[model samples]
Target: MKNKNLSYKFYVIMSLSIAAIPVVFIVLSYAMFFTHLGITSLFNIDNHFSGSVLTTYFYIVFFGILFGLMFIAAKYFKKIIHRINTMEQTVRKIAEDDAFPEKLAVIEESEDELNKLAASINTMIDRLRAKEMELSQMEDLKREYLKQLSHDINTPLNALNLELYLYSQNHNVSKEEVDVLYQKVDYISKLVNSISSEALFDIDNYYIFKEDISVHKSLKQTINKWSYLLNKNNIEYTIDVQKNLIWQANELWLDRLFENIISNIFKHSATNQIVITVGDTLIIKDYGVGFEIDRDHETTGLSVIKNICQKLNIQLDIESTNAGTAYRLSQE
Candidate 1:
């Protein structure tokens, strides 16, 4: 395909060379006629040469000029063709190797059409790279949202499953418990619908649902929701919170923060006792195998916790040792 395109330009130059033949013939015939009439003063000399020699010199000069022009044109076109092929090869390498490259070489000193073409190609490559980065970031954000959604909904579903199990075992489940389960179902529905919208695509627009709620109540509810899992793992927990402690916060986010902390404890902390204390601050500490603070360590749950703390204007401090890990949260 590349050779075919170059051949077309060669054909065009050949056609131009052929078209120059008649113009050359006309000039030669005029010169020969003038010499035949002894009107050779236009040649800038007296008639000291024969007509045949003068005719030969005219033919040589005109045809030589024609060939010289053709040679110059072909050389110029060859440079252009080489430049275009270089650009084509660069693009082909990127497509075939799927690798990133810096911008194409653009000769800023020249104000010709080829320089403009190179500039245009560089601009196109930059825009495409920017768009690719944007898409990649969006994909990462989407995955995070999905993981958060999974964690948020999973706790409530587990609570619901526990309720069903208790009922099956002939245990008396209260009416208020059923109402709370209904509210969780409704909250999950709203979250799912919101995540489906374009608002979730941007980080700035992620959390808009906020309300004034009792912090004690939200924390207690989270513990109760995770009661089944905690018992299954033989992990005991205690909550010490003031009954009337209230704070303005996103209710779901508050619940998620507590739930994620508790979930992380069960998953990572190899201990049996978990304690929570809530007042001006909320603290959850576990007697378990803690990690080194200086080391870089992160998990999905911890990342979600940090993000929520930042969003809700909460100050989060974590202390870890071989004995235990303590997470302290306070409004800032």
Candidate 2:
């Protein structure tokens, strides 16, 4: 495609038009000397007519040529303006990155530079559309994978939970720490149930349009619901949350994220008390046996928590090298 700028081709046309003037005058001058050219001879009018009649003929011939040239220039400029309009619309649509319409032919029917430029742009846009389709197909594959994973994990966990429940009650365990094992099994089962639906695994879309929610309120609600379990486990916990610390999040998802983390803290850590400090960031510190970072069995909860924190742009800081684990969240 040729460059669309007027200077690219229009200058050539204008220069030719200007250069033709001297050549045209020279041709007329020779014609006048040899053929005795006049309005009468040029138009084959009556030679006997002279003075005022001859002057009138000359005026008519001069004005007729002038009007013809003017008309041609006007028509040329009008076509150029129309091409400019078409190119403008095409460029705007491409810049907007709108999907190209079917049968949307951006053809360069004219041999003009502007039309050729538009045709080139349209060709590039076609290439982009192909890549876009490929990306879309890849996204579909990802969704299917997540959906299949969820379904595969869902059905088996229920039966596993029933087996574990029976084992916890019937086995007559000697160790008090057996409660932690049972708790881990039950929480994992619940986590499986919650994520059984493929829609919730849409981490990419979830945080994009997350609504503003009360971090403190959701935490309190989740804590209240889990109070019975905490008491049964005899795990002491502290809450020091700032009033009305709002964050952009899905409230239910945030609650679930906290539930998984807290449940793991109670199950894995030999903590007498866990302290939660909510200010600029929400912090959960457990003063107990520190996590090995790699030996934890609550992989399901950890997976869910990690996905949520990452999607929501929430910073998840874990300190596990010390006597306990500390999880802190901040806005990214």
Pick the lDDT winner: 1
Ten-residue segment with the worst summed lDDT in candidate 1? 1-10
Model 1 CA deviation exceeding 4 Å by range = 1-199, 242-244, 293-296
lDDT (Cα, tens digit) per residue for candidate 1, span 182-253 = 555655655565455534457776655677778778888888767767888898999887546666788877
Q: Which candidate wins on TM-score?
A: 2
- Model 2 stretches with alpha carbons more than 4 Å out: 1-12, 19-60, 95-98, 102-112, 172-236, 240-251, 259-273, 277-332
Residue 197 in candidate 1 has what lDDT?
54
Score candidate 2 by TM-score against the native: 0.57
State every prediction's TM-score relative to the real structure: 0.49, 0.57
